[model samples]
Target: MTAGSSPRAVVRRYADVTGHAPVMPEWGLGFWQCKLRYWNQRQVEDVVEGFRRRGIPLDVVVVDFFHWPHMGDYRFEDEFWPDPEGMCERLHAQGVKVMVSVWPQVALSSENYDLMRQNNLLIHAEKGEDIAMMCWEPCTFVDVTNPDARRFVWDLCKRNYADKGVDAFWLDEAEPEYGTYDFDNYRYYAGPNVEVGNIYPLEYNKGFYEGQLEAGREGRIVNLTRCAWAGSQRYGALVWSGDVGSSFQDLKAQITCAIHMGMAGIPWFTTDMGGFHDGDIEDPQFKELFIRWSQFSCFLPVMRNHGNRSLSHPHADDPSLAALDAPHERLLKEEGEFKEVVRAQDGSPRFYSGADNEPWSMGKEVEAILVKYITIRNKMRPYLRELFDQAHKDGDPIVRGLFYEFPQDHRAARLSDEYMFGPDILVAPVVQAGARSREVYLPGGEETIWENLSDGQIYHGGAWQTVEAPLDVIPLFARQGKDQGLRKAIQEASA
Candidate 1:
């Protein structure tokens, strides 16, 4: 298993056996913006406009889940999203890429459900009711394992989304997250879910990856999926830890996830910046947690800001959005055998949209902190792009454990809290709540020197140093003399 070598050597060997990541597109490297559900065309446009007005560097804006008439409609709901093409064109004109969400669940009431069901494109329940998930309604997962089924879905996506200037797809439910985990109950065209379920996400991404290639797209395919299998990296699957809660505990867990996911060969990774489940935007404790997490997110391979933030108010002046703060009563009209599309009182498709999560949505102090980190991320794009190129060329990870670089240092081998962002930048994220400073272990003995990126203070390796980590500063150190210009840029940005 490739023993008796450095960690980097072992990872390179692993890449030789499996595969290397594709070169990521330039836009995919910068900051991405998203919330729970940007349900309408107008809301999506407004977020882009907000970023433009504030001059925040935004690479991609995600229109997350339930923009469709139904789960399997594969097209935007006409009533809510009046002009998908024009909206995408407008975003592209602003230099922002659009990522639309697509789920595998085919509801019984969806317009294409009958066609899919008759064509045997849906997953089958061997002995019970054929429903695979009941998350929003009774629905079955698409058997993406089948080539015909893969082509069937990708064709719809190409016509409805890709053709409309949408730049990428968020393959949510790549796990086909079922309402229940009875793996044996379901079967796919490939095999029984329990036996071959691991391949589901691989094929799930392969469908779109192959489709994009067929459409003549080259070196620019990025599918942000929730789950991934072995070799999924080859398909340009940027995996994110899914549906986590908002807590300091959850924040600590992401560091481990990123490091291990990179080790496991998924080079591209991200997380919901403020956690996905519940983050109260106005809570002082949450704002602190969010600031800390946003700092951690700055060094990830893809720096994306997303969450389902709990809000006290809608923040918009529209009276229709007043219902957003209220309980989602699931106002629905029956179709035939199943409950139909989730709707609001005004007969529009309704999914609970969280509070404003824009860079400027938080209070002035938090907003200033966010803006600073975003500026730093934009400035580091060249460095990040080089790291991504390494990943593509050698199967090396963008986020790596200290042991990968300083294997001889016993303390660095034991440390889990700090990691290397490529070979140059060292990131020690503040994972605890209300903590100002933390001890950082700089590896590589006297031969290595680290420059404090924020203030240009210097420190030698193979020692533990307690750094001053204020609210605005994320403890970052540049290795040796590698990023002098970047160091100056960071100091100026902080200044």
Candidate 2:
């Protein structure tokens, strides 16, 4: 994966659905696998209704992968959705844009399979043979590198964008399928000998980005790529850390990882909203963890919830994956028995078996914390909008660290665990559990106001403050003129 190219390189004002540069939100909301179930339609409609009823400002609603009738069929089932355009129009009327997940591979014995085969638009192995890999479907990777292949893919998107009236795309699983565990092995008609495995998402997204560009006015590309390589940022994309497991350690690591990514030149940074793996939020203690995680997540560019729905599973990384292995290994050669060859790939079709990471951890108590922050977030929409404006005008991140705003201060340079949200605010979240107090170092700015909205108490801030938070508070500090209030007019409110 290519790492270094240029940062401040102006890719130009992006063309979008409105024929102008889209004003990216202060942050976004994601309901991962939660939005894809049979009951999801009812749940989604009810939620959308709830938001509409409450006048909640929702910028985007991500519909995750395979919402269509048959998995990998890519057809919007008339049963599930008789009218896709009608759905989009309704959502748009409520000022909500839909960004749905789409995969790059076409499954075996499908129409897309025949299409790729006829055009030779799929990927191939190093030996110039078909390189099939394991995915949910007996899927073969599409050669997004080829011009004709790109055009074909864009055509598919155009149907969704123009005919169906969708808004954006969340390109999922762009990582080229590789490994001995898979069963299928079809050669892709992509760039010659592109052995790069992890770099696939970058290559994969280039088409969507450009296609959206070529789409003229019907679409805007908002790719939530899981596996991104270098130079992936130029496509005007937002990337989340791949399949992060749920754990306090992982939560802390997520913060560090986002900071590292920011330093590496990726401005829009995020991970799974609640940790994607391990821990039971059903337990009161863990529910508190999820609530705390959500409190911190609002500051990120994109907030997404992913992974297993069930909370009863043990917290193991690779516990009892399914028996249906990738078909790449089995499709070729004289493999003895189909049963023996069907080595089930990791996890079930819709479930990640490893760990249990669910929201509603710590239950209503945690919900109270999240709701409080969400209220504050709602209140700060005006100022937050200004930040988003700046991010679009100049490549800047919504949530920055302490040092980024205080580069001159050696103390700020030393504070990696904590960071400044923008130019003024400092956020030092309690990354660990069972912690009454966490250490926070400021840049010794001119003035620091430590305001705990929970208690309506304000503390003077400048140096390190090892405050006793007790797991219910997010330590937020205002550098100086931090009293910016909400800008958007609240027509009708539901407190």
| Tens-digit lDDT string for candidate 1 (1-495) | 654478888888887777778889999888999987676789889989988998888999999988887889898888888899999999999999999889999999999999999998989998978888886678988899999999999999999999999999999999988888899998899889899999999999999999999998879999999999988999999999999999989998898899998888889999999898667777889899889999999889988989877655434664545453345432222221111124555754566566678877789889888888888888888888889999999888999999888888888877878899998889999988878999998999887999887777899988899998988878899886887367766676777
Candidate 1 TM-score over all chains jointly: 0.93
- Report the CA-based lDDT of candidate 2 relative to the real structure: 0.56
Q: What are the Cα lDDT values of the candidates?
A: 0.86, 0.56
lDDT for model 1: 0.86
Roughly what TM-score does model 2 have, to 2 decimal places? Answer: 0.75
* Positional deviation of residue 149's Cα in model 1 after best superposition, in angstroms: 0.6
In model 2, the Cα lDDT at residue 168 comes to 72
**Which ten-residue region of model 1 has the weakest summed lDDT?**
331-340
Question: Counting only residues 3 or more apart in sequence or on different chains, how many pairs clash (N, Cα, C under 3 Å) in candidate 1?
Answer: 0
Model 2: per-residue Cα lDDT over 332-426, one tens digit each: 11222111121223422331122222223235566455545555566666666676566655555566656566555677666656776666666
Clashes of each: 0, 34
Off by over 4 Å in 2: 1-40, 53-57, 69-72, 127-131, 177-199, 217-220, 279-281, 313-363, 445-462, 486-495
